[model samples]
Target: MAYQPPVRDHLFLLRDVLEIDRYSNLPAFADASMDVVEQIITEAAKFTGEVLAPLNSVGDKHGCTWNPDFTVTPPPGFKEAYKQLCEGGWTGLGSDPAYGGQGLPHVVNLSFSEMSSSANMAFSMYPGLAHGAYSAIHTGGTDEQKQTYLPKMVTGEWTGTMNLTEPQCGTDLGMLRTKAVPQADGSYRITGQKIWISAGEHDMSDNIVHLVLARIEGAPAGVKGISLFIVPKFFPNADGSVGARNEGVKCVGLEEKMGIHGNATCVMQYEDAVGYLIGEENSGLKLMFVMMNEARLGVGLQGVAQGEAAYQAARDFAKDRLQGRSLTGPKNPDGPADPIIVHPDVRRMLLDSRAVIEGGRAFLFWTALHGDLMHQHPDEAVRQKAGDYMGLLTPVLKGYLTDKGFKACVDGMQVHGGSGFTEHFPASQYLRDCRIALIYEGTNGIQALDLVGRKLASSGGRAVMSWFAEIDAFVEANSADEKLKPFIEGLAGAKAQQQDATMWLMQNGLANPDNAGAASTDYMHLFGLTGLAYMWALMAKVSLAKIAAGDTDPFYENKLVVGRYYLERVLPETAAHLAKLKTGSATMMALPAEAF
Candidate 1:
């Protein structure tokens, strides 16, 4: 089955739920009226469906070819598809207009991103990584640096990659052995071997700009000593044209990954590659987070995208594939056997995927709107609040979504049975592609830790408190609505569980950090369930209003049904998470090294 972008859902979220048009006062939204946004999404859907979806299995089969000359040839059709992507100006949709971009809202760009990832996750990495790099430079780069690189990057004439993990360092940048020595020309000589550098040496673009993190000579040890440098594969001249090859920047080898095979995950060798400083020296960790946070959100979207694609494949198969008879009786009496869709268990699987995926979509879009407000809103207090909300929810979006996304993919595969295990169906491919989302952009465990340890206490818990208050206000406002009783009740219960868990962590984690570490994952999920429940309540509220206003659209009706299903079937997981969180770390750390 061809992948279908969920354009209707996006529209529902944008217009009815988020009401992005209300922000027309922001510069980015000046041209993003509903009609314009709808047209853009429609075109994006057509492009992804026509150009990228078919190439998904093609790329997976052939993968990228690495040559002895340190260059990479992407799977066939990728270069052409990428060319189309650039020509369509999709790469610069959310970029600054001063540098040849469309300057659309980040939420709009994210919706398109979800579609692209669903079509071809491997192919999407080329531009996705470029976008992140563009953001880093646009945020932290000097004026000269931005003028030189941002335009080309925005145009997709030159691609970009980030180099952080080395042979000895994965998440711990303090242990990185990569070194950068300052030179006479105010540049740095960066010498390092970075591992797992995606889009490191691909031939799809004119030049590859690398954002590298390295420790300058004689700097203080650990993460504080690190700095970011702009290390390109080829130097750019005064005219912004490709110049001499930066010596020692080479792709030594590619990592044979479990999935996303078309993307070149390269072992990059940088030996005295010329690099320019980005932002202030020894402040690389602080600045690198700008890129990391963006990438993390993108990874979360990757989870949703893969789950959407997998669910479509599964749902279509269930509706058509003939199998065992229905328990209630033969709905398809004329056929040999009723389609598997008649089975309760199968419906359960489908609904599980649907509930999580749709809820996650709302969560992502809501957070993205907060991101836009944080960046573009004129009001300082509003920006600060938006930023805090983003901080509080980033972990849930990344950790919870991907964790559930992988499970959703597995459920999709389970729906396929034997065919799912083989490559004959796309279900397995989606499963493979989604597995990485959980591990990258900081593992889900790390995300959980960050949520409990840092974000929970950020601004003295202002963000979390505000989040609880928002839910409280909603529940209180809807208490009189009989149509919303079930949803309100379920959401209220989940919110209370979340608050209790938060308070427990606050009380217990202060005495022993391990309690926080042990409870982090569950707390994150508990927080996630509460978040999704809140989304469902909001969605259900809008849906009820629409139905009350005499709108007979099945879309609104289906929204209410799905929201109900989530509240009844999925949101109950909050209890389990809360129970586990209350268990603390006593037994988890009881074992000694010798016992293992």
Candidate 2:
């Protein structure tokens, strides 16, 4: 089966479970009635299913080609598909109306992102990077810079990229050798080589926006000296039209990636390129963090989106491909063999994937709602709490979802049996494509460290404290609901261990910092488990209420079953994470170099 948009599930989560209409008083929600949201999602489904899904295999087969004239050609039909995407206004669904976007609530626009990502992972990255660049300038760019770049970017007329990586730097920006020289016209001349730049040289737009980070000549060493600059591929004319080529930048080469071949991962060279400063001097890192944080959330979504794609393919195969007879009896008595879906093992993989994908969607949307509230809520307290949740949960969403989501894709391949090993099956493509989510936007290991090292202590520990209080309130409010008691108990049990782990880290981590380092991954994952359990609980509550009101839709009943499966089969792994994290750094750090 082709990757159809999971529109039914998205609607159930947004309109029913989240009940976004309850926030109709907020600016973003004022126009986001379920009717409007449904219309947008329906159209997006049609666009992605028809325009993008057919290109996945074509992209994987042909990949992107680096041309002689310093331009890279995308896979077959990508240029035309991108034109349709731009014209449809799908790129700016969540952006501000002031900059030519649809001005919908982010959670609503997120449905399109998830759908497009599942339909075409490789093609999705081109616009994905542009959104990150748009957000950076959106929040930090000066008014003129916004007017110069935002309109075209929101309309997908021009694409964008973040230039931070170098031959020497991936995560460590301190040692970067890129330099910016101040010039007579107040424009700095940027000179550097940036590697692994996605959408760096694709022939899909009028001009490319390069958000470069460089150290000014004679500035202080390390990250403190860094600054952000706007260096477009072509200068804008007096009427905001594309002008002369800057003639100082070029795509030297492209990386042949393991997957996502549809996106041009270019190695860029800058030789005295005209650059405009953004924000305050020596504060680029601070500004870039806004873009990185948002990109990290998108990366997490990509993981689950790939899982959804793989799971759908596997689900279709299991139903149609006949296999050995059912051990108990012949469900297909007239046929010589039963469908593999009739077997318990096949059910395990399919159900496990379903549970992860659905629960993951609930978690993503739940977090994204807070992203909307963070900026638009009326009360300062609500805004602060929302902001804190966004910060605290970003890494959890990135690290945990990618870990499990990739595994789900692998399980999808296993479900396809030998066919999955070959390139003909989409399962192979899904698994390969899913692998990069673990490494980019900072590896999963770095995400864990950021969680334990940075976020937990931010704002005098307000973020984590706020998260705990909210989860506690949820559990207390629903403890007496007999039908939801198991979910509540599951959430409570996992959360209690998380609280315990937090207490241990507080007592032990500061004194022996390695304790935190060693326990970081498990703690982050435990946080993931607890967070998903809470999402499942919220979904269960909504489904139960629907069933109570005499809504006989089997969707709600299936929701309850999946939620139960999550709580019973999947959630118990938290115990191991908690146990392993509490072990600290002693045995973990004892091994000497070359011991292996």
Best by lDDT: 1
- How does each model score on TM-score? 0.99, 0.99
Where does model 2 exceed 4 Å of error?
A: none
Clashing pairs in 2: none
Overall lDDT per candidate, in order of appearance: 0.94, 0.92
Model 2 scores what on Cα lDDT? 0.92
Q: Across residues 79-171, which tens digit of lDDT does each residue of candidate 2 receive?
A: 999999998988889888999987899899788999999999989988989989999999998898899999999999999999989999999
TM-score of 1: 0.99
How far is 156's C-alpha from truth in model 2 (Å)? 0.5
Clashes of each: 0, 0
Q: Cα miss at 134, model 1 (Å)?
A: 0.7
lDDT of 1: 0.94
